[model samples]
Target: MLELDASAHPGGIALWGAVLAVYDTSSMPPEIGIHVHARSTREGDKQVDDTFDTVVVKLSPDEQATITGDTAINFYLSRFLNRDIKLLRCPHCDEAHLDAGYFAVRPHRRHMCQACGRQFNDSEKSISNPVSLLKRVHYDVPPVRAPRNLDVKQTSYPGGMQIWASNPALVWTSARAEEAGLHIHLYDSQGNIVVDDTFDHVEVDGIELNEVHVQYFMAQQALPHLSEKIVSLTCPRCDRPHFDTGDSAFFPHVEHTCEHCNEKFVSKGRRKLVVSNPFEAVRKSLRANWQSHRI
Candidate 1:
């Protein structure tokens, strides 16, 4: 088997490396089954959708492995969410980090210390968010593209709205980014041109227009559209992140409080996301609708 470089992302790699190093896989179970469960968070949903995949690795019965099936399952599950490597410490009873909250980024949403046997609770530990984790692992790595300085401004037109597309525009630059992938509506001030930017090209939405949204629109050519954005903010009280749903009553009003820190934030109103990539916006809309109704 080809070996993966262990030095990369030292913390996370080290843990997996240690597992691989300690596992004597020469003798192990031959038939291994993997069952992945898609958990639904809808109300009144108590069922899990299970998808199974099997791997047949030839091994001896006496072969010793550092990790077992259940442990391996947990290990793989950790990969779904990006974790910080630096926060992990000694898993041994001795020399282990004794904390109830996050020990490292690699193992996130931890409830207990595997090494020291401590129960994690709100008062004791600090939890990381998914966006932060993503930025840490992939965004912060060295020798990568530098962060762009984008000047984004939004304003209203007569009957629609206009959001200035920021630079490093993936839509224009990435060839792989299909036009259909665009989820956005461009309208002229007269509320005349309601262009639905679709995958291959833009289509007119009710409002008559000569063309879809051009790369540039005159200030006079914009429309007035309501904007509802979801923002995640850390609570001032407990410093835990909560999604701000804005203020709208027609949609579900969720009160987001940090389960650990008891920090409180309210996510009110309906979530309205306007995507310049029509495909993404439509897809997200479909998903949202499905989730809302399915639940």
Candidate 2:
């Protein structure tokens, strides 16, 4: 319930107060605007190394007034949690910048940001919070290392395995191979056999070139759904509303030219034009109307 402007605190006293609240298992005010949870303790900073503290939490971008304080907050939280922590989906993009990879949830390793394209471990660029993140439950996946014995039998693919893959069109079954009793040959639509030549090999097709990692596979399955929401765009000179487009329209309808700035603008998804910048200035009566919408 402590409310104070960040500037009013010395040596980030306010930040320490938030950390203390979480460490004490106390509830934060609604105005605090972040979820918190406890995590395993980690090494670093004698203070954080000795006590329970905030580990992970989400923060809206605007709440992050400066990058310096954010970094300090993250350092303290990571030491408190003893693990790499990160902001979840970007509030603006609402999409993860980090692509699902083989070691996504591994303990030591950290996930990358699908929005800002920054590694979670890269403290220099990450946004931090005073609260922690809640752990979400997921199907327990086993490791996918090669069997110690090469002569051992191969693993089989689980049901709904076909739904995995970044590019579905890139995946298809080689029925001809199966017909010849050669086993199910999965090809990368380009016919570059991805996990082919192994009839009995279970779960042959993996995200990686070698054996597939389960975390990566599960992530690949959920990625598309996350990508389905919110679009992004770049405004060269004259800004246009790019993220406001609907989900049904194509790129052609999203392109627009700015008269005043004489710059070309483009949108990535189906959202209609609404001035892409969240804080665009009014220009209705300006010389040439710096912004315009494409049909």
- In candidate 1 the C-alpha lDDT for residue 156 amounts to 29
Q: For model 1, what is the error of residue 19's alpha carbon versus the real structure, in angstroms, after optimal superposition?
A: 21
RMSD, candidate 2, Å = 22.8
* Candidate 1: residue 232 Cα off by (Å): 14
- What lDDT tens digits, residue by residue, belong to model 2 across residues 1-295? 2222323221211122111110111122211112122212221121211111222222222332222223333333233223455555544545433322112222333445555655444334333332333222112322132222112111221111121111111001111111111112233323343442222123221211111222122222222232332233445665543322221111124555554465766655555432232211111111122112111
lDDT of 1 by residue, 194-239 (tens): 5433322222222212112222111111112312332333456775
Clashes of each: 33, 26
TM-scores, one per candidate:
0.21, 0.16
lDDT of 2: 0.26
Off by more than 4 A, model 1: 5-92, 95-111, 120-281, 285-295
Worst ten in a row by lDDT for model 2: 165-174
